[model samples]
Target: MSDGPTHGAKSFRLPISGRLLVISVPYFWLLLFLLLPMLIVLEISFSEARIGIPPYQPILQFVENRYLEIKLNFGNYNYLFTDDIYVSAYFNSVKVAFFSTILCLLIGYPMAYGIARSEPGQRTVLLMMVIMPFWTSFLIRIYAWIGILKENGIFNNLLLAVGLIHQPIAILNTPAAVYIGMVYGYLPFMILPLYTNLEKLDGSLLEAAADLGARPWKTFLEVTLPLSMPGVLAGSLLVFIPACGEYVIPSLLGGPNTYMIGTQIAGEFFLNHDWPVASAVAIALLVILLLPIVWYQRLEARNRGGAG
Candidate 1:
């Protein structure tokens, strides 16, 4: 018999070149869409604000005698610290995002747990309900809330019909409205991750805990919560990251007094026509957000190391 005797064999292996190409696709995409745009923004941040079509002075130019000249404005970064508005906006954005993350966790955990523990047929229907809002336009959904939360809107009308309150409460165009919108919009993000993690949990662990005389709540605290931490962190990040830089929700539902980094950045870029300052603020926001991501990675690494 020949060393290679099989005549009906089908090879599914990719060549080295093919593997490299597959890997490089995502790298190429990141370079094009993410890195390149960031590099442009970074370059703009180093430039000075100027009255022009582009609205900023170039950092790099060919000067007299064909010499390359570079002018970097460190004031852009300093301006963010010096300005009270920017400083306050940063703090407020972080505060809102933190609270929103907490609220989402509180609300989503139970919903996710229920979904995870549901019958297989029912799980699909429940999951569909959780994600159903996504089928509609996000803008439309936010706009719909405007009708519901307005002073004389559906909520107040119902309350008045039941004589629950003497007057209509001012909920629209307020921080309360912003929080409600944030929670409503980002709840799915929290739920999906928690459900994914919880669904994979071993039933035997719970059974063992029960056999060892642990109560339901005690078993959940000792066994379930610890195991579901990855999902918690993942969901928190998913909600917190966008909530920090949230422009639409704040702009629509939040009042003029609502100070957030998104609104501040928008003002600098559009109203003030200060591109460099806006870019600097954006870079600072990116740095702030990057810290949590780095921390999460290190935590995951530590968990893996301990497990190993």
Candidate 2:
């Protein structure tokens, strides 16, 4: 008998042409939207610029005046490393991002855990409360902080009204204000991922550990913490990467003494009209951001491999 015409298998099988079309559409869209823009940025990053001219200066003499003269220069990158200000900005960006990410994780993890462990209906309500802040415009929310943190703002005014202080304290345009803004802005990013992972945890495992003579803390340390690590990694990366490149909050809340790489790059591009240097700074920021991501991916893969 010929092994042919499996009726059940044929019914379950999708058309080959349809499957190919489904795969091709997403690949085409990715290339068009994501890959193409990245390539353009990379191309511009390598191109040289003169002092008086923009990075992509048109060359009238080339290709019957249709083609632009594209010169490659690494001077901008060289300048980034050799300059003290840029180097300091790089370190400062990393330091602030790292600390802010840590703070967010510390604050968010407990909140997420509490929400995740609550009764199902209560958990839903609690999660909604956490997420409701995002419905407002992020920029507007950050701006609202300015009124609260300014020297003569509501915080100081209330304190003075209560006779807690003799004078209004300077809070806005300081590193502390920047930290507060960053933590507030990115806390949700940390909490959501952690809550998602923690919600999936099996209560039976903890019970089993207790039955096997494990203490509550021991069970959490050995099982719960390890299982929730993926969420921790995801949340940390989400917070750290963006915080490193944060521009608007830092600009609004921080003084000149608190300049970050993002502001420096913006200054180079807009204020100085130095596209090459701006691109260089952007590329440097990208590199710095990628290091943590790459490390996280490696660690994640290793953990998965060990688990498997």
Candidate 3:
């Protein structure tokens, strides 16, 4: 008697068709947007250069017998590997991304920790301040940095007024400006993830350490830092991936000395009109970036498995 209605209710679920429809919504979206573009780019990467709109020789051509002739061009891929300029740009992108991720971690961690420790009322305000940059257009924010970093701009003018320097120092159109723009643009990404991790930590863990006569610094090093590693990794990846392909910041802030993979890719596509070559370079960038990303994903999967 007790099991009859309850058991029947528990066993009931949405129809299989209904469940399949729900799953297919997001699956279809990913297939249409993400997977489709990747496949198209991968296809283009193997295409030959052609003179015309679209600018790439099709991979398949129909012969007289109705047999498809496949023309695969490895020249674009070969050119990327052979050219020292492309190789240097790849290395330069890695260098910039590495430094930017580090800087974001250093600057963001403390800010995130502070926010995590704050009273609930204050935490909201602090988070708002961190997110305030998003209120304005990202392009505008990047452009504004150009003015601030310029020799005759607000930063130099303020320094001059305070007698900190005899003349305005050159900061605009330099690698330093690129670094500044990256850190400013990507800092919040680092902070939000770190904050999410840190805020959820048990307070009693710290108390227990304090009770055991552990120094505050020692407790942090042992307890807090190790616990925040997941956040650190997530935030670093978030910053590193975008920074690697960042075109606008480097183009606007960096000089001729600061050529990156994005700049190289953009030049190949727009100026050279070599779609195949550009697509190959893009595929190569993804391959280069995959190392750290795949590692992180594997590590995360292992951690989740262990937790389960």
Candidate 4:
């Protein structure tokens, strides 16, 4: 019997090879697309910008009688640290993203919970309604908000018709508009994760708590809320991180006073032609954003260990 496959030797080599291939593809794609691009960006971040030349240039010039050289410089990072404008933009981004994420959570949690507790068919329809808006172009959706929030827009017109306001309000080009647009855009992200988690929660546990003389609010706080923590964290991260880097909504809906890090990076790269500075800013933003992810992972690991 061929020694019974040598008692756990690599007899099924083809199956192992197939499994390895399946696992390796995704990692290979990630390295090629994500990791390599990030490494390139990091390298560019450290390089000095050449005057009258783009940030990246071939080492050897293809044309005759033309010369090219690549140089490394850290001045971009130094400038970023010394300048106050970039620092302020970074802080503003954090603040705006934080508030927007909180607002999404406040609004989405209840909606998600209600949907999850509904009948299965109703839950599917409700969730579909939440997600259906995303089928349209995101840019167009944001632009639609512009028409609604602009001076003499639909909101002002409606308010005026009801005699709530005699004149159009300057809702456009304000932080409030920015907040509205962000919350609207990211609400689905917050709701979907929450719904997924809450749907998985065992209703019997909640019922048991109620049976044990607990009120509805107490049962929610003690049982439902803690169980939904994973979804909350996941959804918040999804919304907050992107909101921090948002440029389009702010630019279209907000005034000149509202400047985000993403907008600043765009100005640095395109308007100022300061590629090194843009790369430095990008790197800094990456670090700032990734710290929370790292911290979250650590906290999650500790929680899992304690549970185990």
Candidate 5:
């Protein structure tokens, strides 16, 4: 009896400890990489801008009588609100991300639905085509867009050869170009999640709807659309979050009028050498991005509670 109890205790502890060890690895990795970097940025956001090697005044310093002094500059955050450039950039970034997400959803949903409904062998081939773009360098892909959207580029050449227009339209360095690049780059992010969700949909429910005299479109609205909501939300988040902070696409494809938060952060850090202000802007943007995730999590939790 004593041996049995000891063996049971060892087995119980082994799995518990193993589970904790596995969980702790990722938590520790996040703490080391994500949390530590964020804390550093948060610390920098509270410091003053300076012309030193670090380009920012340290917040912690030893004072007279061996006293430690902690100086926090709220001015960095205040400057963000006071400056119209930062304010405008924030709004513009959000606007671009919002519209781009909507466009992706519109385009990707159909593609995803089609793929999900295809034969199993065709599904793999279609998915490979969708994912093949990722095998190429992201920068190279964006650069390819530059060639395609330029005034005298392939797009305009095609239009001209077809007698569609008198001259090449100005697309490069415009908001339209930005939208094109965003949609092109992030389309896969939207499609994969939607396909995953739509593929797992119950065929029986769809058939049941059809038997109930629902038209295909009506059945889709009442059955398919409702079931695909999770995919829609996931894909939107995947697109929106990265698009909001996109720098390279905007810098390459978008004009001054399309100024975004990412551009603002870079300019602050590099051009102006204002580390505090840049850090503050970054932190503020992080907070804005986190809000949506927090809301989604709460909504998910509430839904689960209701179901329970």
Candidate 6:
């Protein structure tokens, strides 16, 4: 029996100088910024809280002046589960993030479709308008919504003036307000990806579908929608992850009933001064956010394999 061709191969290695230059840059950056901070947070999450500047007890200590003692407290993680507040916060965050993402999709898809189908000259103008809000500060935009959603605000005033309603309806400090702000603020994120994907769609595909006796709506359902799924996923993750951990919008617009992970984490760290629990919450939140990214990568890999 002969050895197969796949059984033997030569592996190439980079030169010492090339390896140093190519790998060192990214490795150095990750070490300094991403890995180091994450490691510090991970270590802190396992330690007990104390009255100190940093608010967490030292994990490593000299035992008997020779042996090192490592203190790892898993109580914080347990507390997150045992406490109903924390559990509810996580659930509410996910719920809000999910519905907000869907709302963005419904509104953004049409806007993106319009922009992508616009004339070349008009498309640039439309895109600029879509991006124009970003030129202003995000904080300022959120504050502006308070004026619109407040009971005595312009929106209510307009409705009153037009005789649409006898009185101002309460809108501020509610879930509806939070959703409105989220959709408004993150609309661009959803639209940009969708437009990018929709723009590159081959026009001939639509024409071919039409020739084959497919109606516009049916063609869109069977052909266009399937092709634009990647953009939908990308845009959804872009909105959902950040919204899951959103602090500013919820703080400004949401009432006491709005329980979210970001607000709970902030409360744990700043108000309660529980550093370990806060770190644990943060780590859990980070893990949650990374899941979609992982899923996207796997899907992309499967797609590439199928394409190949």
Cα TM-score per model = 0.88, 0.82, 0.89, 0.84, 0.89, 0.89
Model 2 scores what on Cα lDDT?
A: 0.87
Over 4 Å off in model 2, which ranges? 1-26, 51-54, 57-71, 210-215, 295-308
Q: How far is candidate 1 from the true structure (C-alpha RMSD, Å)?
A: 5.5
**lDDT of candidate 6 over 38-89, digit per residue (tens):** 9988898999999988899979999899989999999999998899998999
**Per-residue C-alpha lDDT of model 2 across residues 145-180, encoded as one tens digit per residue:** 999999989999999999999999999999999999
What TM-score should be assigned to candidate 2?
0.82
| Backbone clash total, candidate 5 | 0
Q: Which scores better on TM-score, 4 or 5?
A: 5
Q: Write the per-residue lDDT of candidate 3 for residues 1-308, one digit (tens) a residue.
A: 33468767865486878878888999999999999999889999999988987788899899897999998889999999899999899998999999999999999999999999999999999999988986768889999998898999999999999999998999988889999999998999899889988998899999999999999999999999999999899899989998999999999999888889999999999899999989999999999889988987886677566555
Residue runs of model 1 more than 4 Å from their true location after superposition: 1-29, 295-308
Between candidates 1 and 2, name the one with more favorable TM-score.
1
Q: lDDT (CA) for every model shown?
A: 0.91, 0.87, 0.91, 0.87, 0.92, 0.90
Off by over 4 Å in 3: 1-12, 295-308
Quote the positional error of residue 207 for candidate 5 in Å.
1.0
- Clashes within 3 Å, all models in order: 0, 0, 0, 1, 0, 0
Clashes of 3: 0
Please identify which of the two predictions, 4 or 6, would achieve the higher TM-score against the true structure: 6
Q: Write out the backbone clash pairs for model 6.
A: none
What is the overall TM-score of model 3 with all chains considered together? 0.89
Q: Rank the candidate models, highest lDDT first.
A: 5, 3, 1, 6, 4, 2
Instruction: Encode model 1's per-residue lDDT on 1-308: one tens digit a residue.
Output: 22243422422266769868998999999999999999999999989998988999999999986998999999999988988888899999999999999999999999999999999999999999988987778898988899999999999899989999989999998999999999999999999989988998999999999999999999999999999999999899889988999998999999999989998899898899999999999999999999887876776676466555
